[model samples]
Target: MVQRLPLDAFFQRETTHPHKRYMVQPQVGGQIEELSWAQVGNQARRAAAWLRAQELEPGSRIAIISKNCAHWIIADLAIWMAGHVSVPLYPNLTAESVRQILEHSESVLAFIGKLDDWPAMSGGVPEGVPTVGLPLRPAGRFDSLWSDLQAFEPISDNPQPAADQLATIIYTSGTTGMPKGVMHTFANFGYTGSQAVELFDVGADDRVLSYLPLCHVAERMFVQMVSIYAGQSIFFAESLDTFVHDIRRARPTVFFGVPRIWGKFQMGVFSKMPPKKLDRLLKIPFLGRVMARKVLAGLGLDAVRYAMSGGAPVPDALVDWYQRLGLEILEVYGMTENCGYSHVGRPGSRKSGWIGQSNPGVDVRISEQGEVQVRSGSVTQGYYKQPQLTAETITEDGFLCTGDKGEQDGDGYLRLTGRIKEIFKTSKGKYVAPAPIENRLAAHSEIEQVCVVGDGLPQPIALCVLSEAGRKELRESLQGSLVELLERINDSLDKHERLRALIVIDDVWAVENGFLTPTLKIKRAVIEGVYGPRFHEWMEYGTLVHWHDEI
Candidate 1:
């Protein structure tokens, strides 16, 4: 029989490898701090002891608001060791959104770690609740500092939680509705994290860059749980401005990015090398290989043996472009409900637009309504305090209904068509799926991000944010290149799916702008809510590509 060890079991076992460095944190001004496994374990123990002294109940809820940092992981482990459920809030959330999550979760205490916007985030925490500040950057005035806790006597024995015990209450950053807290057990994380390490062949020698939000399940698994499971050394990115410099110093062997980051990388490349010249240079064999190596090295991805992208569907053309530069960007398909252990595109997967085969021990099937349904040990127990929502999300047959519409190929690779709720019917009574069309349109280097919206209109329209290349083209050619690109896209799409016009917007979508979620997914409903009323005016303009103000 398989033993169900507690999640903190990894920390206990670290005594066997006490001297091994587990985390490398880069500070400002190029300073570096390395912590051994034993040091991390001791900090975690002291943290747990500190929590225990507070007299909170074993299952009390604790919130963590911070960027990706070594102390973030320490706090998470400490929460579990204290037998408390952790609730992670995104550092980029507005004060109101943060208040809503904290109030809803009934969090007893919060740990404030590294933050970019503390004044806004501090306003969200309830006035009476106690707070602890992490080592590097604190969100607000803390009752105690994480460093001060190290002086306390470490807990002699850690709380040995059962496998099925609640580990975390992860709130989904919904685009439209209020965010819901999804509950997952320690067993759920252990099963999925182990499977991922095995599938990706993560070892103690592997190095990883922790720059993504640890609050998100994808980064939580890839950076925190996987690092603990495999005893890998984790590197923390200091800040956005120093991300490239930090990565260069770490030289991580495994890396993961959202589609938006990959898109930005492509734009950065184009800014240095014009597309036409780069295309010409790539045609020459030996020179092309050398150029690719130099590019990857400059981006600090030269040592990356495994790279994956999730949170949004990366355009097929973007994946192809990276592969040409000798970096294969594998696609990941999963959600917060399943601990993010779903279908993953393996290395060298040639099939375009597919998210690859099902992960080991995961069962996936397409329902009659075209929704992707999955059943796995890693699936969450349910949404916290929302049984009706949980029942609606998970079927009676034990499958979690992934809201995404998808189809499985003969080779077992899963190809997502569009979101079921995102499919809209036009005034002509025809249904259109925007993802495929958007995917094709995103192939154009000028287009940074595109959203297709037309709920009750004659047809759908494209709301596009342009890259620097696109901005230059617009200034020089009056949207001439963009118009041609849209014409080509229309030729390939069905009549209903064809865009009425390409409406160019000047503002870039960002978390602070309320255009993107913390995970960097485009907020479709939010976008539609802002632009839906102008569809008729845009259609009547009778231009193939129009500016946003034209309405």
Candidate 2:
């Protein structure tokens, strides 16, 4: 049996292991920076000492606001080392939302990184709390993290936190209200890390590109934890714009991405060589191998040994398209409450349209209502402060009410249908899960963002926002091509689930517009309200076919 270990032990273990590379960061405009296990551990120790000097009580909540960086990991380890809980905030969160999270968590201190407007965003820091800014620029004000580390002695003694003690509190946006803090423990993270190492064959030889927000549980668990446990080197991408450049520079052995990023990669490849050219190349056996290598290398995916996609449902077509290029895009299923992964598609065990089998030590079952329920050591104990919500979500029996509707096959592969709350009922009383249908429509290389809505209506409809490349693709296609694409989508759906109409919009749905969460998850209710009336007008006037349909 695996014993429960404290979070800091992972780092200490790596420090003692000779030849272990702890971290690597691909600088935006400079050379690749590497850190050994000893170096990272020493930095984390100094950070812990600094936290101790602040005089905060053990288990005090501390917040981190920044993009993915080396300092972010150092700060996180320090927080755990000092027997405190870490709260990571998304870089793009609004001032109001940031204030709410800090206030809700009762955070005592905050560590900030480079920002566009520091003073304005710093206003979110509660009164009487100290704010330390991370100076990306050498001359910036406030005590620099590197400078502080140089001044303080490294804290060596490890204070072991109980297995049940809270480790981290990750906030996730809810459908109807403010985000809730999902409280996890040392056991939750440690066990999940071990399980991932075993399942993915993660080892010191693996290299990971850490670009996604550490605030998100998916990245925190997979990229961060897997690296620490397996002694893999993690290279941070400077930003989204430099993602491709960084990926090529790192040549990572493991890659994890959201569906949107994966879809963009596919679009990037198709843009260089159109489908006709690709189809023709496939017919030539020797030429196909030559062409595939050239294309994969050009896209910076040539060295990626394993690619996984999560955070949202991925379209089957997108997975197949990548698989054709010798890239097996494994679809993983889990959430913030489950420490990011409960099920993952394994090599030689991948099945289309399924999220794969449950990870070891995880128990997953489909309820009579089709809601997916999971019981695992990695599962959160409860919500931070909402007892009622916790009770409703996690039962006394220890199963977590996943809130996602799904089904299990005889072989134990799980296929997600939709969210229990997001499913809509038609006027004919037929319940429709928009996720599968929406994923199918969005699978077309052109679509970017899509929302499916038809509650209390005769049939469901889809509101789509085409990508820049998508709009260009539509423009180049013949009028008959557009009709054929729509017909093809319709054929994939059942009669009741077929989209009544499609409305393509030029505007993007984003957090700034109140149409998306900070994590880029669509706020479906908000979008429905904004576009509901317009959709009705188009349907009544038969103006839906117009490219510039007001609705």
Candidate 3:
């Protein structure tokens, strides 16, 4: 049976653990800061007392908008310690998006963190709502997190919250429309965290370096919860620009990344030493081991005992490449509704194109139409304030409709084919699942990003963006590489499903451009609409070489 504990109970248990290490920050200024479990507990207590002094009601929503910092964790725990629900906003979100979340969540208080410009972003907070700024460097405008804690007396009494009470309200990226808050109970998070630690064998001795947005469910559940549950040290990367350097400095035992970041890491490896040279080097006996170790070390992944990829589909070729380097990039499948972990590729049993078997205590099955459904202890009760969506997403039978089309192998491993909503019909009247084909094409080292579109066209065509190193390595002209890649990709598909043409996009799609979610999953519909008119030109011309190549 699963044991349910409040979020604070983990912190309390860790405070007594011999191996407890809390709030490790890798600084860009070539320094490292480490905090002990006792210290973390004290800080949280002080913050909780301050929050109580504010006269906020229990279960009131408090918002946090910032990158992944040590203070972000502190603020999160403080909110829970004060008997409130924590609402996290993506740090890089636009002002409009921020306003939408703040209004929708009905946040009574907000803690803003280090941003490019405070004056501009502050406008997003609703009028009459109390906002506190969290500055990395000492700023005179707002109360410093440390100062606020120091001013308050430690609250010795533990905050009483039921296991089934709401603990967090994490808003989804809203790729389809307005983001909805996914409410998770204390039991939901506690069970998910403990299960993950047990499944992965994470322990007090492990160390995790978290660089992904903590606002996302994947990082919050895996990185933060695992650390708190296992009594392990939690390290924060200084910034995205210095993530590689921070990783090398921290030498964490566990690492997590989105598909895009994993792809970039693989591209960096191939760029440093071309495949031909790497293959030749690996052929040597003793030197091969030394060179491979050096290569992995240089990539800041040498100490990684386990690496996971989630939030999007990872190309199989990338997984194979990492496997060759003595690293297994385990693919995970889950969503905010499931508390972030449902299926995980087991260590030493990974298969290409599969997200692995269902996790312990999670029941998974496929419907007649291939939609993946799951019933798990960690599944959320429902979406916050969205009863209609909740009714549509979760069935009366208690199984959550994952909205993803997938197939299960005889061994019970799940391989996702595509999102049910993303499947489109071709002019030939055949429904095409674009994700499988896109994943196959993206597996090629030359392709960095790809989107398949054919809603009303004769056939589907792929819009591809090549990696910088891939462009340089291919040696051929842009048009030549596109044709070669198209031929290579077509070899793996049926005649009707094969890509009809290739359109090379010079510019990379990113979150800032509204092409990707915060978790780095491509917003396919947005991309299709942005490039829809150009499809005709590309299909007629058969090639586009320029940076702004349309079609």
Q: Against the unseen true structure, what C-alpha lDDT does each candidate score?
A: 0.86, 0.80, 0.81
Order of the predicted models by TM-score, top scorer first: 1, 3, 2
Candidate 2 residues 166-262, lDDT tens each? Answer: 9889998654578899999988988888888888888888888888788989889888888777778888887677778888877888899989888
TM-scores across all candidates? 0.97, 0.94, 0.95
Superposition error at 239 for model 2 (Å): 1.6
Each candidate structure's count of clashing pairs: 0, 0, 1
Candidate 1 per-residue C-alpha lDDT over 289-344 given as tens digits, one digit per residue, 9 for 90 to 100: 99888888988999999989988889888898889889999999899999888999
lDDT of 3: 0.81
Worst 10-residue lDDT window for candidate 3 reads: 542-551
Clashing residue pairs in candidate 2, if any? none
The best candidate in terms of lDDT: 1
Off by over 4 Å in 2: 4-8, 26-31, 116-120, 137-146, 474-479, 541-545, 548-551
